[model samples]
Target: MDQVRVAVIGLGMGFSHARTLAAGRIAGGKLSAICDLNPAKQEEAKATLPSDVKIWNDADALIASGEIDAVIIATPHYAHPQVAIKCLSHGLHVLIEKPAGVYTKQVREMNLAAASSGKVFSIMYNQRCNPLYKKLRELIADGELGEIRRMNWIVTNWYRSQSYYDSGGWRATWGGEGGGVLINQSPHQLDLWQWTTGMMPKRIRAFCSFGKYRNIEVEDDVTAYAEYENGATAVFITTTGEAPGTNRYEVTGDRGKIVIEDGKLTFWRLRVPEPEFNQQYTGGFGEPECWKCDVPISGDNPQHSGIIQNFMDAIRQGTPLIAPGEEGIHGLTLSNAMHLSTWTDHWVDLPLDEDLYYELLQERIAQSSSQKTVREVGPVDMSKTFGTY
Candidate 1:
């Protein structure tokens, strides 16, 4: 494929995006430009980026420059839609950071625009590249696990300290970062939860604990109950305050069960389908036997870089997307349902009420305590956070 020129906005997460898209790392990809509103960040990009990489303080001008064939938007939580819209308007392929937008309504606008742009629109849901998740989805889809009966995840290892929340005025505010962990740290899990299972909850009844673990107004602790259309149920539990937290994802089906944790996957396949065993087994006390095996996952997970490569390939060749930008709304629907359920203290239905969600979200913004428009922390080794992805 021919080389594709790319620019990244927001030096925050863009730091990783730019580095990953560097010319030598991926063939047919070029880190052509970097844009940020902060002049200091632009200067820093100049010092750190490749000499040939252009730096711009104005995103609009960079989008208009005709110098970049595509753009990676790593901007703040709320700016995703607008920035992506700008790129699509200019007929540029876009690879966007997750959470797609603060809400489904905004993401809908972006997705609609992408449809007209005829460009490769992808979201950075890089976890889809992980072999463990890949195998799990394969098993479920192949009916190796029969029909999914239950899904549960306790992804609390996304621990963040008070300083982490205080690092930016926009960190935890309802108006700023949307709704805390669900929007920021957990979009990956939320996306993976829905994607791996290939299921969408028809109903969500969640309990949110706001400021229970942090000093912010948004939720740091969330426990939700979800019921699928097929009568299967799921439980999602997460928090950002726990020390030495756990990351356990388990799925149970009629065939057997699968557990994924600590970078390992285990599958217990039933010798006979549960329905047959239950209906025909003559023994009163005997049940269908299960074969337990450790599902091996070989090769490193490509993660963010994988998504970028796929995006570039989609632009040049007709490759499939790891996570279509339009599908972002499914994960956001789960996140927004969790929040809206907690807000109304009732069940929230699928295809959430866009108007009601937007109205309630505004109430959250009205409660913000700080509105400073500056980043508090400096960039660190993002590899530590992304962790072998």
Candidate 2:
């Protein structure tokens, strides 16, 4: 009971989690076990894993074995919720990767079990650990951007080739990963959109281009116009098809504007509120005075390793969770709404109808011709550590 024993399931992207725990980054935790279905992957894990690491072929057996106090679920999109439900049932703390699951209906089920289980449940939303984003969220919450007027995010730097899609049979497929850029590549941005702004879209008119730039069947490009509950309008644009792409997140309000890009947070503060300036000013050709400030960011952006350390801390130290597993539904719901908007060709409402979304997703799955080819995936790249809330 002195050391927190942890097991990471699904060795594809789970490799990073494994390596981090094996490195003894968390003073109270260590990589105790690993689970993967591929024999080839098992062999690959064996060579890199510590001498004391336990290996298992079946995830269900591994969860039920009671060999570890916590398990990080980095499996496929569809299996995320199911495996977490099982692990929580067996009294194991769970840290699941982003998007929770392919659909909200299933993710809701997982959330329900977590609510009843008295276990430490967290999500791998590592982007929340970024100091730049943390500052942005703090500014918005403090109303520095008074009466938020507009928000726009253009994150299109996720260029991927055919081999990347072919790297895994379950990737970018309707029945496999569910949706394309929206589901796979844009979850972090989507989560940050809602998380940083402290608002969810009331309605969304989304346009998603499926396979527009790739040979895959899921969306490669997406543009969405959203209206918040406070009557603020926002636009979100992302793609995996653009090279030398741009990542700009800006929000304009009555008092100030915040722009975050290239690892910097810039602020344009109005000397006078826009409404006050418009009402009191006699000039016809001028605007409010502004002060431009380059916000300085601090703290380490440990990302994936940061989330894992926090997860271990939550269990061992009773510290606060960075991203609770239950909150993941909001971002996934947003992603599903965008896809539903494209499917129905109209504006979709928030708190989306779960049954309707499930039915529509099933129809696409039934019609999809994409086949899944299960094979051994290699190690995780360094860029794979940036997903978050």
Report the Cα lDDT for candidate 1.
Answer: 0.85
Provide C-alpha RMSD values for all models, in order: 5.2, 5.0
Put down candidate 1 lDDT per residue, 1-389, tens digits, no spaces. 48898988877877888987764676678999887767677777788778999877777778888999999988777777877887899989998888898888888888999999899999999999999999999989998999999999999998999999877877887766777889988999999999998999999999989999879888999999999998899999999999999999999999999999999999998999999999998888998999999987887888888898888888888888888999998899999999999999999999889889988887767667756321212232221211110
Which residue pairs collide, candidate 2? 127-388
Give all TM-scores, in the order shown: 0.94, 0.94
Shift of residue 201 alpha carbon in model 1, Å: 1.0
lDDT, candidates in the order shown: 0.85, 0.86
lDDT of 2 by residue, 1-389 (tens): 46788998888789888998898877788999988877777887799889899988777677788788999998777777877888899999999998788889889989999999999999999999999999999998998888888999999999999899987766788877788998888899989988998889899999999999889989999999999877899999999988989999999999989999998999999999999999999978999999999998989899999899899989988989999999899899899999999999999998888888888887877767556421112222212221111
Please count the clashing residue pairs in each candidate, in the order shown.
0, 1
Worst 10 residues of 2 by lDDT: 380-389
Prediction 2 TM-score vs. true? 0.94
